[model samples]
Target: MSPEFATRYNRWRYNLYAPVYDRVVAAFFAPRRRRAIELLAPAPDERLLLLGAGTGLDLDYLSGCRQLTAIDVSDGMLARLRRRADRLGLAVDVRVMDGQRLDFPDACFDAVILHLILAVIPDPVACLREVERVLKPGGRAVVFDKFLPDGGHAGWARVAANWLTRLIATDINRQLGVIVGHTTLHIEHEESAGMGGFFRIALLRK
Candidate 1:
């Protein structure tokens, strides 16, 4: 889809789901996300950046970190994230920024997390490239998302999954690990969870 079309669709779906977004998403991905974060084990004082940080579901769990910036495109989602931050008494600077055009300096952050984001992004390659560009030398990034099966039934399955996801959000089935490898990134850790050949949490570096 065109960028203009994709942006409109994304904003529309997110606004439509804002009322029940937290309940619906948390019920499905919370457990897996917690496990992924544990596996990543982000260190203190690291300049961490969270992309597509919907409702701050992972913010509470990120208390051990020093400085953090959470960015998302949806205003409705960001509002909920603010509330979540208030409730937890945490100070996470929030912004409504495009993932494909990060408004930050190069090598400024220690870590960047594209949690559950790439799958739903309209332009996965552009998004990943931006992440790579902003990452500091030897900085790490963790990508936790679902994609098509590696080989078995991948061709058709990926297409179908992406088609359906477009009704709710824009998601592609390309494995983030492979995509990262194709870019200027190195994989550090990788894990898969869930059936239906979906979901993975991978740690990568640039």
Candidate 2:
């Protein structure tokens, strides 16, 4: 698919899913999200960005940080995020923006939070490059998503299933290491989360 088509597809798909997204994903991914925030440990007054911040599920975990910015392509999703943030009495700057092309200055943020976005976006490398660009030197990013383990092979079943999954939400076979390696971010720590190591949290530094 063309880049524009892919971006539109994701935006449309997520917009369709926005109403039920938190209900669908929060129950399953809550633990991993909490762990990721714990690892991130955003300090007060630090500027933090959340890429593809669907439904603002991570906002509560970020209570300590006063400055929070979240971006997503789907206006539906971002709208829900705004409501959630307001209900929680948290001040968040939520925007309808593309992850692959961040409209931010270099080294502008102290940290970035990426949750379940890499596999969903059309260009993971470009997204990571933007993450690196917006992050200040010594700043960290907490990433939580599903990826094929490094050096591991995808079985025939997974390869076949990915075709359908990619049509709706995510690519099941993306290799996290390869995507991260293409950018300037350094992997500071990594650990497996969720079932059978299917999900992982990686702390990356710029």
Candidate 3:
């Protein structure tokens, strides 16, 4: 699929999944999400950006940072996020924005949070480039996502499944190292976050 088509499809899919997103993903990813946030350790008053902040599940872990901006392509997701933020009294600036084309100025954010987004987005390289552009010098990005291990091969089953999975949710064969290599961001720390080391937490520096 083309980039435009993939973006539109992702938006439509996420909108349809928004209502049950928490029930479906939150519990399973809760541990990794917490670990990612812990690694971020945002200071008070620091400006932060959350890419693909679906349903604002990470909001509770980010309460310390007062300046929070979250962007997602799904209107339904952002709407749910807004309600959650309000109920929790968190001052988050939520916007319907594409990750590959960030609307913020260069060097604007002190930190960035990217969880469960790389595999789901169509253009991971472009998204990471945008992240590199918006993050301030010495800023860190906390990323948590499933990626194929270095030098490991995807089985025939996974390769075939990706054909269907990409139509709805995530691609299981994304290479984290290859994607990160496309930008200037360097990994400062890395750790296995979920089962079988498929999901990982990587602290990247700009």
What is the C-alpha local distance difference test score of each model?
0.79, 0.92, 0.92
Q: What is the TM-score of each candidate against the true structure?
A: 0.91, 0.98, 0.98
User: How does model 2 fare in lDDT?
Assistant: 0.92
Residue 184 lDDT in candidate 3 = 91
RMSD for all candidates, in order, please.
1.9, 0.8, 0.8
Q: Indicate the worst ten consecutive residues by lDDT in candidate 3.
A: 162-171
Error of 2 at 29 (Å): 0.8
RMSD of 3: 0.8
Candidate 1 TM-score to native = 0.91
